[model samples]
Target: MTEVPLIAPLWTVQDVSEYLRVPVQTLYSWRSSGTGPPARRVGKYLRYRPDDVLRWLESLDDGAA
Candidate 1:
Protein backbone atom coordinates (compact mmCIF):
# COMPACT_ATOMS: atom_id res chain seq x y z
CA MET A 1 0.00 0.00 0.00
CA THR A 2 1.26 3.42 -0.94
CA GLU A 3 0.65 6.51 1.09
CA VAL A 4 -0.96 9.36 -0.76
CA PRO A 5 -0.07 12.93 0.04
CA LEU A 6 -2.80 15.11 1.40
CA ILE A 7 -3.31 18.78 0.57
CA ALA A 8 -1.72 19.35 -2.74
CA PRO A 9 -0.34 22.78 -3.75
CA LEU A 10 -2.96 23.40 -6.36
CA TRP A 11 -4.15 26.99 -6.38
CA THR A 12 -7.42 28.70 -7.17
CA VAL A 13 -7.85 32.27 -8.36
CA GLN A 14 -7.91 33.51 -4.81
CA ASP A 15 -4.77 31.59 -4.01
CA VAL A 16 -3.04 32.97 -7.06
CA SER A 17 -4.13 36.45 -6.10
CA GLU A 18 -2.67 36.01 -2.66
CA TYR A 19 0.55 34.62 -4.07
CA LEU A 20 0.97 37.35 -6.70
CA ARG A 21 -0.63 40.14 -4.70
CA VAL A 22 -2.99 40.80 -7.57
CA PRO A 23 -6.74 40.96 -7.52
CA VAL A 24 -8.69 37.82 -8.40
CA GLN A 25 -10.56 39.84 -10.98
CA THR A 26 -7.22 40.60 -12.69
CA LEU A 27 -6.50 36.92 -12.81
CA TYR A 28 -9.79 36.31 -14.55
CA SER A 29 -9.01 39.05 -17.03
CA TRP A 30 -5.58 37.64 -17.71
CA ARG A 31 -7.00 34.18 -18.17
CA SER A 32 -9.49 35.44 -20.73
CA SER A 33 -6.90 37.56 -22.50
CA GLY A 34 -4.53 34.59 -22.79
CA THR A 35 -1.81 36.55 -21.00
CA GLY A 36 -1.63 34.48 -17.88
CA PRO A 37 0.21 31.35 -16.99
CA PRO A 38 -0.90 28.35 -18.93
CA ALA A 39 -3.44 26.58 -16.79
CA ARG A 40 -5.18 23.27 -16.66
CA ARG A 41 -8.93 23.32 -16.33
CA VAL A 42 -10.11 21.01 -13.62
CA GLY A 43 -13.86 20.69 -13.83
CA LYS A 44 -14.43 24.27 -14.95
CA TYR A 45 -11.95 25.65 -12.44
CA LEU A 46 -8.64 27.19 -13.39
CA ARG A 47 -5.61 25.42 -11.99
CA TYR A 48 -2.15 26.88 -12.48
CA ARG A 49 1.05 24.91 -12.45
CA PRO A 50 3.55 26.34 -9.99
CA ASP A 51 6.35 25.72 -12.45
CA ASP A 52 4.49 27.57 -15.16
CA VAL A 53 3.85 30.49 -12.87
CA LEU A 54 7.50 30.67 -11.91
CA ARG A 55 8.56 30.43 -15.50
CA TRP A 56 6.16 33.19 -16.45
CA LEU A 57 7.53 35.38 -13.73
CA GLU A 58 11.05 34.75 -14.92
CA SER A 59 10.15 35.46 -18.52
CA LEU A 60 8.54 38.70 -17.57
CA ASP A 61 11.56 39.70 -15.57
CA ASP A 62 13.72 38.89 -18.57
CA GLY A 63 11.78 41.50 -20.53
CA ALA A 64 9.54 39.34 -22.64
CA ALA A 65 8.32 42.30 -24.62
Candidate 2:
Protein backbone atom coordinates (compact mmCIF):
# COMPACT_ATOMS: atom_id res chain seq x y z
CA MET A 1 0.00 0.00 0.00
CA THR A 2 1.21 3.46 -0.84
CA GLU A 3 0.57 6.36 1.46
CA VAL A 4 -0.58 9.65 -0.01
CA PRO A 5 0.26 13.01 1.48
CA LEU A 6 -2.65 15.13 2.56
CA ILE A 7 -2.42 18.78 1.70
CA ALA A 8 -5.01 21.50 1.94
CA PRO A 9 -5.62 23.56 -1.16
CA LEU A 10 -4.47 27.15 -0.91
CA TRP A 11 -6.96 29.93 -1.46
CA THR A 12 -6.72 32.58 -4.14
CA VAL A 13 -7.28 36.28 -3.39
CA GLN A 14 -10.82 36.08 -4.75
CA ASP A 15 -11.56 33.04 -2.64
CA VAL A 16 -10.39 34.78 0.50
CA SER A 17 -12.39 37.87 -0.34
CA GLU A 18 -15.54 35.84 -0.91
CA TYR A 19 -15.08 33.91 2.33
CA LEU A 20 -14.47 37.07 4.33
CA ARG A 21 -17.17 38.99 2.58
CA VAL A 22 -14.78 41.74 1.58
CA PRO A 23 -14.12 43.27 -1.80
CA VAL A 24 -11.35 41.84 -3.92
CA GLN A 25 -9.79 45.28 -4.05
CA THR A 26 -9.86 45.45 -0.27
CA LEU A 27 -7.72 42.31 -0.07
CA TYR A 28 -5.22 43.80 -2.46
CA SER A 29 -5.19 46.99 -0.41
CA TRP A 30 -4.64 45.04 2.78
CA ARG A 31 -1.80 43.14 1.18
CA SER A 32 -0.18 46.41 0.14
CA SER A 33 -0.62 47.80 3.66
CA GLY A 34 0.76 44.61 5.31
CA THR A 35 -2.32 44.28 7.49
CA GLY A 36 -4.10 41.31 6.00
CA PRO A 37 -3.78 37.59 6.59
CA PRO A 38 -0.37 36.21 5.75
CA ALA A 39 0.12 35.12 2.14
CA ARG A 40 2.81 33.55 0.06
CA ARG A 41 4.00 34.55 -3.38
CA VAL A 42 3.57 31.49 -5.58
CA GLY A 43 5.15 32.10 -8.94
CA LYS A 44 3.47 35.46 -9.64
CA TYR A 45 0.31 35.01 -7.60
CA LEU A 46 -0.58 35.26 -3.91
CA ARG A 47 -1.77 32.15 -2.12
CA TYR A 48 -3.21 31.86 1.38
CA ARG A 49 -3.37 28.88 3.69
CA PRO A 50 -6.82 28.18 5.06
CA ASP A 51 -5.41 27.78 8.57
CA ASP A 52 -3.72 31.15 8.39
CA VAL A 53 -6.93 32.82 7.33
CA LEU A 54 -8.84 31.20 10.19
CA ARG A 55 -6.09 32.15 12.61
CA TRP A 56 -6.19 35.73 11.41
CA LEU A 57 -9.93 35.84 11.98
CA GLU A 58 -9.45 34.39 15.47
CA SER A 59 -6.86 37.08 16.19
CA LEU A 60 -9.38 39.74 15.28
CA ASP A 61 -11.75 38.23 17.79
CA ASP A 62 -9.06 38.41 20.43
CA GLY A 63 -8.54 42.11 19.76
CA ALA A 64 -12.26 42.78 19.99
CA ALA A 65 -12.30 41.60 23.55
Query: Best by lDDT, which number?
Result: 2
Residue pairs of candidate 1 with colliding backbone atoms? none
Clashes of each: 0, 0
Report the C-alpha lDDT of model 2 over 11-63, residue by residue, as the tens digit: 99999999999999998999999999999999999999999999998887455
Clashing residue pairs, backbone N/CA/C < 3 A, model 2: none
User: Residue 27 in model 1: shift from native, Å?
Assistant: 0.6
User: In model 1, which regions exceed 4 Å deviation?
Assistant: 1-8, 62-65
Cα lDDT, model 1, residue 13: 77
Best by TM-score: 2
Give the whole-model CA lDDT for all candidates, comma-separated: 0.82, 0.94
Worst 10 contiguous positions by lDDT, candidate 1: 56-65
